[model samples]
Target: MKKTGIAGFLLSVCLLLAGCTSQNVDTTPVWQQTLPQTGVQMEVSNCTLENSGPVYYAMDRVDTDYWTEKTAVQVEGVPVVTLYGVDPEEVELRFVENVSYLYIYYDKVMPQPDLDYVLTETNDGALQYRLDTVYNYEFVITTEQGTDSMMVICHRDSLESANTGTT
Candidate 1:
């Protein structure tokens, strides 16, 4: 009986170690911000989100599989950047998470400064902009169950600090 108990303990320890090792570690940096309008948390990577800047534009609505804007739009970026998006009433509880790709389509949106990217024309004649060198990055979201994957789209301009004085 004692031998059986010892074997069981060893087996449990081995299983625990295996589980720990099997989990993948995500090194990507995620900058999160809670919208003051609705008190919702927006988790994202590849950029920074801010509330205190000239209100460039706001997140208008989200469809079944896409997040879009209401008025015209713009996305300025580099390998890293500061982004601004306001208006939480329309956004409701549509918080951004696990976004792996961000697509910005603004009417007559201006070009990106300090970044090297080209604008492409879609098959439908709408302009598609590639504002960053890294196009499709990965986002790992660890939930209570496990890690979940998601895609992303967002934009911003530089400011001093988060929710600080305006630019």
Candidate 2:
């Protein structure tokens, strides 16, 4: 009888613990929506932040397995998420308290002139995820493929100030 009672107690405890287990729920803001494809896929769900998660970087393959390996550096080989239709202003709302970072992924081998609107790169004979020029809160990440790169932008004056001192 005691054996059965102990087993019952253990079973109940196990069931209770399992029920309390946490789930991996996505907490993306509702205002955040998919970006229209301009050569890039239109899925905001694919859009992620360095602070929120790890971004995969592969200089050779876009295979699911490769991305699963987990890399945080700039992509040099495959896949980039874009915020095409979403304006910087709309993005500003998401990072009000958090750091305002932007990852602009260009799916092409952009020439220096082509990026003049945002940045200017050195004439070095090699291309990589690099940025040079105006915009103190922005970063550029390039991939080796003929398409797709990511640019991370930070709007300090506007959103950085939104940080509240409270815990």
The candidate maximizing lDDT is 1
lDDT of each: 0.32, 0.28
Whole-model lDDT, candidate 1? 0.32
Over 10-78, each residue of candidate 1 has an lDDT whose tens digit, in order, gives 999999989954533231335444434333333333344332222222222243245532211112243
| Residue lDDT tens for model 2, 7-92 | 99999999997874432323232123221222322211212232323343333223324432221222111112233322222221
Candidate 2, overall lDDT? 0.28
